[model samples]
Target: MIEQEQAAGLNRQQQEYLDVQGYLLLEGVLSPSEAVQYRQQLLALAAQEPGRINPTQHVRWLVNKGADYRKLLLHPAVDPWFRHLLGDDYALSTLTSNVVRPGAPDGRYHTDFQDRVPEPLPEFPLTANSLWLLDEFTPENGGTRLVPGSHRWRRRPPPDLAVHPDEIRIAAPAGSVLLFNGGVWHSSGANTTDRERVCLICFCLRSFMKPQFDFVHYLSDEAYAEATPELKRLYGFTAWPQPVDEPAAPKRRL
Candidate 1:
């Protein structure tokens, strides 16, 4: 869904869509049964331990729930998109499973590159998000809210009431991944449902900075002690030394 194209020319389609729309929705990225299982496990876990949510605000854990959640994290369809979007010189990383339970307060819209960027407002984005829907994301549910194409505007995220009125909603089936640039101003929509709306949002960067979640610390000693190299790498380990000698990339403007 996000891989770049290489034919001795610019990736006209992805580049154009990203430049104008700010986000690309990939439908049917996950099947019905797959969505069911993903939702089931996540809801069960969320119920078993309500504390698993974000300590500060949302609830979340970094564990291998099942095949549906694991496989999609490193799916082939997304590979091409990442390859083109973030050059080969980079790597893909996932934080602990991000479980935002129902009733969690709506999140403020902030740039994902705030710390990295020298300026508070950069023209373009350095970070992107892959939000994997575990349950049906409805406009009413705590579906992630975004101001489409705000990535280029370089403006502050508006309050929810101002951008999305009660009538306008964003929902997607289970298994779908909403990919967008971090610079795009957005927020977490309030969950109006009785049940929880779970998700595993991965903030993949260009392999040059520290991960938001320290995968090594989150994974229990027993879990990481016997993990495979592939698993370790996915959790933030690297087989070789990473490069950081080059200067930071230029910022994009609206």
Candidate 2:
């Protein structure tokens, strides 16, 4: 169990909401100092990233590359929440980050996974998006935009050029880490502020699910060797066989 000091910090119904709606808001979990460091490392990374942007001119698939920024990927809150949802055998996809420069446009509303299943939603869900807000996620700053309960229905709209940027905005504070089920309908909002908005988005999944970012190619053998066994398991090193070797994985401590 989380100690009273820490557990007391989380709202009572937050985890319940995450389980049912595929998302939850965690307030005040990060320190201002942490946010400052995250922004520093990510900005430097974004400057060096060479990949093509998705119409946003920001970096993507930048986990292993941002080694210094990995702390955000392994926060105390994230581990407990992720273990609660995905179980002990799960792996850390990577340390995903992006620097949303000023004038970047609002994004499309859509689920983060492939659209295929029964007419209605599936019995179970897969995929999770853990976003560590390095800046104030304000309506004016282009914080992530999400429909409250769209995850239950599995519905979303494409990036609507017509919709005003403010319509679906969610303003989160600098220390707030937003954990949502991947199927939740949402999009990255536009940054109107002159300064850049940097975010550390860590993708995690059940041990058996295929990862979104290619962890295999992103991590080098040297990094893997230096990483501890737990870190290795988090990076897809220990292959959890098909059909699930165990049920829900073992209970996790800390």
What's each prediction's clash count? 13, 3
Question: How does candidate 1 score on lDDT?
Answer: 0.60
lDDT, candidate 2, equals 0.68
Q: Which candidate achieves the best lDDT against the true structure?
A: 2
Each candidate's lDDT (Cα)? 0.60, 0.68
In model 1, the worst 10-residue window by lDDT is: 55-64
Model 2: colliding residue pairs: 22-181, 92-234, 108-159
Question: Residue 237 in model 1: shift from native, Å?
Answer: 2.7
Candidate 2 per-residue lDDT, tens place, 1-254, comes to: 44542363444477667767678878787789988887786677666766654435555555556455555555677777776666667776556666677888877776765455334555345667788888988877778887766667754445554464434577788978888876777778888889777777877877786766655556665565567777767777576343445576542221
Candidate 1 per-residue lDDT, tens place, 1-254, comes to 32326442335686678668776666677777776776676666666775644521333444444344445544665544444455443344554345555666666666565444554456645667777776778877778777776667665554444453422245888778777777776767777677677776666666665556665555555555655665566556662344456685442110
Residue 168 accuracy (lDDT) in model 1: 29
